[model samples]
Target chain A: MTSNSPVGQDFWDELRRTTQARIGLGRTGTALPTRRVLELAGAHAAARDAVHIPLDVERLAAQVREIGIGEPVLATSRASSRDEYLRRPDLGRQPAPGTDIPESGADIGLVLADGLSPTALDRHGAALLAELVSWLRDRYTLAPPIIATQARVGLGDHLGAAARVRTLLVIIGERPGLSVSDSLGIYLTHLPRPGRTDADRNCISNIHPPDGLGYARAAQVAAGLVEGARALGRSGVDLKDRSRTEALGPPSGSEPGIQPGHSPRRR
Target chain B: MIHRQQVSGVTYAFDGLVEVMAKATPLRSGDQLAGCAAESDGERAAAGWVLADLPLEVFLNEEIVPYDTDEVTRLIIDGHDRSAFSAISHLTVGGLRDWLMEMAAHDHGAEHLAAVAPGLTPEMVAAVSKIMRNQDLIAVSAAVQVTTAFRTTIGTHGTLATRLQPNHPTDDPRGIAAAVLDGLLLGCGDAVIGINPATDSPQATADLLHLLDAIRTRYDIPAQSCVLSHITTTLGLVEAGAPVDLVFQSIAGTEGANAAFGVNLQLLREGNEAVRSLGRGTVGDNVMYLETGQGSALSSGTHLGVGGAPVDQQTLETRAYAVARDLRPLLVNTVVGFIGPEYLYDGKQIIRAGLEDHFCGKLLGLPMGVDVCYTNHAEADQNDMDSLLTLLAAARVPFVIAVPGADDVMLGYQSLSFHDVLTTRRTLGLRPAPEFDAWLRRVGIVDDAGRLTPFDPTTSPLRSLASAVAP
Candidate 1:
């Protein structure tokens, strides 16, 4: 961002190109430059607001239908409000009567929840859901998407169990950092049910426009995991993302896992 | 009889709670440790006699007048002298007109008694501690600091130490490494040098651990490091063999608060087991770190419905006892000022709340410390922290956090600084934990007189790279 300046700013431009991280920003005597401060303040505001603002589940459901992902059945978690959800994560992780998660018979449960950042869903939920439909709509029967408000990763488990879906694909908004408030995340669980621990699911984080896991890549990853989970009869640490790994290039010969050795993302 | 047990010149509580206590686990390791279970059994038998014989007033409400209270009082009337506590406990709260007049002559005795009484409430501790001399305050309290395989307590088992929490703006190892370097150069890290990395992913946590591991190993510093994030994250890291000395989590005083955090006793048990399996504990079998503050409970609306619900912050904090009573922690920090003046308005209020949390946590039989801090928006300054820090030290708090430059860039708050630690140690004639102190001396950071020498960061292995990467 600083590279567009005229005062010999080539170094900062180089750094910016190499990493989206806020490095090489010139400072003003013991403090950050004013523009950087303003940008950060704006970003922080977005993150905080994202946590508090309630997502319009009806509008989200309509958007999903418009995108032809299928008509989503709007639902609410046990947490009725943003404050309650923030206070009680377990409530958000449960499927009570309010969520309207229909009981019985579906090959897969699809949940689109306004998680830690509702803004993330507003930005990328429809796109990702549409992408998932393009890939797996014919292969598996997706129960009407349950538009969840105030939800957590575990909410997917509850939704799937409520619908008796064999597998689940839940898209959620991850907790926003000082920057990057709209990062989307996907959690896939096989044999989805309540009381399914974190180890019973797989996580693919940081899906957003530009500078993140692209929807295509995220779909590829999710599809691979789902296929693996159905074959192995489970998800999470037990199942590897080896399918995606092989697709990415030369086989790493390891299970699907986080690659901490090299991948860099702005926290 | 006013029965009691004393070990290593420290008096142990063998009263009401002990009656229900399964067995005592040695909280810290160092000098002579008389088996807690043996004494606990003895106390349990004595309590059994009293429970069966003593007619007690039982309330359906939370408050119950323990038979031990009357038994202890009866012994005092019968001329028991093992503790001035017998004399102090039976006192009416009629202020100067009541017990203070008669107890003035037993000032020294009461102060000592109060320090070692494990079950004394914060208000009671404050009252007794208020009457003692500053010099007496230090002497009576446990001055012994406990250390884990990688971490150390600042003072004695009951006294205070700072848990240096150097959080990075991001979970960037580079940023955290710089901040930690700053704190270390100033002779902080008396409490375990831990970081609160912003990144929630387990891989990033592993990176932070591996980075600190390399730094500490290269310097041979006597400190353990942890990314003071969620216990689940730390649990995963521990399972992965990342260098974790303490598993950290935020717990509240009520079941609702714990639920809000998605935590329950079962999860804590699992986490404790995860840390225990490491077997890297240096301080006896104790190996847990829990954090609790007030707003969390109130925000959950748990405080509104119950008849005796925690209406105030102090009462709200005590609810944490319900959670802590199950999982025994090696270190617990009552992050007082971090709540800001709204909950605890101004310096005086902050000081009182800090003491109350410390007192309450200690009364519940956990090794406790106070995190002396304040947010930027709070109507507090360094002067307030200085006063609170000194009082906490005088109270012999288990630990306090010594941040780099006293400011946490990531958390956006000001807390105790590395300079503060040095100043507190030098002025109070206090030192870091024994092993940590030895490490400090061995590294020539402090002299034989326990005075800090001039620190030259240029000499550090990280200096060259840090300077190269300096923003």
Candidate 2:
């Protein structure tokens, strides 16, 4: 059998060990080695599972209660079923009827929803919220985490407007990938409402560890973002994540004029 | 900066102001044949591979960059170390072209250049890919639509197909059905008579599907139709029992990009299964149709970091592979030039990307096709698509989309025209999917020898009705 890993196979292996990219998974007898192929197949399954597996919302709610941080107001999006959430994205953004909320306004409306990767919330949702709650508990009036099922970043708008908060801090699971599945994202919007577009928010992505920001650091950045959005009068392209050195993709502040967050228009 | 404005009234000198509007011009479209020599069956067959074998990869170069570039050559001799590309990190497009041409001469032009460039920028490799003519790697994978007695495979040897895009200004069925008849008269609709509905409403999309389904049943046309709207809308249409032969989705390399299109792998599978479960694939199991290109990962911000190398195009290609590998699509199109010159500069770039994407998609074992198209605002013309389409045909590319009169009024771009399909069939001895071919023959559009004869549309049933539906 002929090896397709190039002549200096060891050198590529050395580089491979340093990063998670699919660089040096050497080929065996024309195709990828069976072991590596299986490994990839496993990774694909894990990523898909991260997306398809329903979140233990009860477990997540219990953890939030145990932490004694923020309170809880549970709700679902217009997408009642998992199938609808996956396809009708617009429904995921609109607030469903009968969401229990506080009539009085709060300083900050904390919303935790399942983004594309439910596993992200399963792993990091409780911890990130606890830290965020710990930091902002003294300075501002914090509402409980308004748990939403099948939610998008814009879902926080409806909750925030209903809660009558000056700002909405949404910590949701970001879309999963082949290498890193389960990374969470935080979107902060100033005066979020039902009709507010993505242009009204700012995103700090990759908010989990190993390849993402740590929970504490992510919380620290979220706090700073809340402060900045208040000072700047708006979010979205106006707000930026400058509390620390960036880790993945473009940092928040660099985008100009365009809606630098997730695409607002549905395809 | 010199501003060439013929203003004799006053001499205005401005420093650092070019007065040029900053626009990331959109990508161009179309694959057509404005001029070509007529040919007989034997003559056309002799010119190119008329009976080309399936899944052929003639241009498989094991050594991607075999030229005497100091960086790669050093790596070959220095026992392979890091920083091999440090000395040659950035080069002009011309400089990159020279190196690539030298490698192409050595029969080793398969280098994945994004593997070693700086993370933020990898345009040189992108430019090189756009320019390199991957003539060696020709491939063909075909899909068939079965009828009562026989079946015909699309992209088989001696065949090409086109999707008739009948779009309406108001998402109204009247105007759209007219255009469908107009295209069918020109020997189009072999690929699939699809529509790009003007609105995004699920009801409208589904209604268009039902209208087309009724038309197909009424005419007894042995062809497939698609409403190239979002898959959710298509799924709704399918559940409503509309005759949806193909469910369409615009796919990107990364999962995030796909989320924008309301698509995930699971949903894609569900849509495919839904269509299959309904027995809608009676003609073929080729159910799902996908559209992809470079830079979707970067644009969607889901592109993984390749250490420090540029990851946009490479990651995007792999992402397409991931989707294709999972779904086993009936048709996959890498709309190369649709993204504009900012991503792909000109004809050379568009042509090169079309081949690379086709090669990569086929390598991932999907039935790959090319939407040889460009946007009106892009820096391209029909001449560009003409060259690209001809090369793809010569390479025996499996399938391409077709529009009427080189213009898709609905999509607002030009694509492979009915003229291009006729040219491909006449000049390369390529035929349409067999069932569609038989339908065309029965309509007396083509003779028994499979040659398209001059058809008097006034005498025909549907083409004449097109005049009523059309302006």
Candidate 3:
């Protein structure tokens, strides 16, 4: 290659080390280097393959049961197959006929769903639930965790309404990205029901281990959101996650609307 | 409104214009899911036949979504340019298709198409598109020229722009900085360096804004920056005197859908005015970057039409262009496959939707781009994106979103990578926006021939930026 490039190898290398994003790969005439090209294809193939991987529901339930919060209930959405689940999102939000979920009237309902990426749920679902349970078990009443297959985020609403819980936390496998296939997401809805829209829920996404949001931090944020939803009688847009602010301490200067410990308010 | 037709001795009757339009739409999973798609190919052909004979003026008289209830319908009616309409007002939908194709073949066709753009409604343009092929969509879209500018002029002929989407999973400045640097080296960001912040909080949005602004200022990049937050959150940042370049919002076709997004025409107008008043542009003042997708209305349950029938996603998607046109935005992009298989299904549908969106936006006189992307769950891969990217490049789309390695970790989708943009530009003999093209040469990132130059990163001029944001 000609010595006509302006980028320094050391600075570019250092920057690449800071992020998972592909950077500083030398190009071959407007094309990616051969290794990088194959790496991308392989990553994409892996991510796509991960989407079709079925969650080991039985193993997952056993792992969650070991957490000792509550018994695990198995369920399936109206979508009977993986192909149907991908094509019909509406079907994935409704419970299959005669699911028989108990209306326990618990304060919190937890649902673990094999969303677009069952591989994500298979990998981190139990560990994240354990962390979240550690934070909530002492202060709140918990219901049996529902492990749903062929499910979407909205399935939690139906499950929550059936369970008669005050707050529903749906821990779902997010759509797999090329770089991170096993990332999990949490959606918290206050008084979740059959018709609750996304605006009625608050999301904490990118929950994976080692690189993405760690289990402890994600659990801390989920717990804080639950507290806010409980205090305000709502979730979603009305509730903002201030746990990061609390951890970082109050801003140096007194800015207007910067209440240190005030309850959640409507936007 | 003549909603019935006969084909192969089979008669098909539609209830109204909305039904005809919906049933006429080319096969897409969204229309099927909306319960408005024609029951069979024969039925679809009949609807197309009926739609073809319908006069362009019929669109002016019949409201698909009732004008009284839909602000989008009202905007289309209230903003109709009578003088412009007179030129092609007599043509039927089929005549418009012929007229557009004929115009595309002529050298002065671009000017004629641009002149008639204001006269067209989203419905009329969409109607013509339904009867046209993917090649026809590309030909007509290529003939029309819609240009806008902020720091760099986009949509100029022979130039393709890219929005450098350097998104971070946590809105971390360092992670974002690395991606931005990577994009810049690959000749991206001519359209804008826009970030979709993981959090919608004003504080996080403001911080990302400052980070982008500092990089732009230090590098003197010939590009604009946007933190793609809700219009309300962005307006608040503008009020707080952040370096707001482009006000970004994800808009839909109907008032109710916009409401679900917590925005209205009035709010968008306010955001446009606020960003324009900032006088932040070095080259031009068109400073709004809007994103639209096919299934947003249906996704939000706001896709209802005349007689409560669900309008097709494509028609509603084209209607969103009117919203973008009203704001005189710097850029408008359809995230074609981003909504997944629920709307577009596999690669073929996505490619077709991408073309239709570009064609309609161009016909409606808006600088249009596409985020040629898809989710992993959508039965699509990089090969699919390659097809769409190549097709859009052939169509001369104003811009496309290019992220690092074609992966948006925050958004969880695959878009065109920086190398993809580079390859597309090289393949089509295209260059970036003029200002950015000049800056690339000035900064020695590329030679005068627009070819990349190898250099030591330690001595690179962008080292300062890397050092500033390095953790």
Best by lDDT: 3
**Number of the top DockQ candidate:** 3
List model 3 lDDT by residue over B171-272, tens digit each: 778889989988998899999999887667889888888898889888888889998888899898888988899999989899989998899999999999
Residues B1-471, candidate 1, lDDT per residue (tens digit)? 233444445544443322212122111110001112324445434333332222211111122112233221221123222243443444432231123333333545344434434333322333333233344334433332223333554445332345666675455555555566555544566667777665566876777778777777777776766677688888878877788777778777555566777777678889988887787655445567777774555545544322232333344465464355456677777777665333544566566566656655554455667778765324456678888788777656777887655555455556776666667766777776666667767776667767655534345454643333423
Global lDDT scores for all candidate models:
0.58, 0.59, 0.87
Q: How close is candidate 1 to the true structure, as a TM-score?
A: 0.56
- Tens digits of per-residue lDDT, candidate 2, A23-68, equal 3333342234677656644654666678678889899999988767
What's the CA error at residue A140 for candidate 3, in Å?
6.2
If both were scored by DockQ, which would come out higher, candidate 1 or candidate 3?
3
Cα deviation of A3, candidate 1, in Å: 26
Off by over 4 Å in 3: A1-9, A61-72, A103-108, A129-144, A164-167, A189-192, A199-204, A213-267, B469-471
Cα lDDT, model 2, residue A121: 94
Output the better candidate (1/2) by lDDT: 2
Which ranges of candidate 2 are over 4 A from the true structure?
A1-267, B1-133, B139-152, B306-310, B464-471
Question: How well does each candidate superpose onto the true structure, as a TM-score?
Answer: 0.56, 0.48, 0.91
TM-score of 3: 0.91
Between the candidate structures 1 and 3, which one is better when assessed by lDDT? 3
Chain B TM per candidate, please?
0.71, 0.68, 0.99
Instruction: Give the range where candidate 1 chain B is weakest over 10 consecutive residues by summed lDDT.
Output: B25-34
Q: Model 2 over residues B207-318: C-alpha lDDT tens digits? A: 7777777777777777777888788888887777777878788877545567766677678889988986765554567777777876554445444322222233532453
Itemize residue pairs with steric clashes in candidate 3: A4-B453, A5-B453, A5-B454, A5-B455, A7-B456, A7-B457, A8-B456, A8-B457, A8-B458, A9-B457
Using TM-score as the measure, which candidate wins? 3
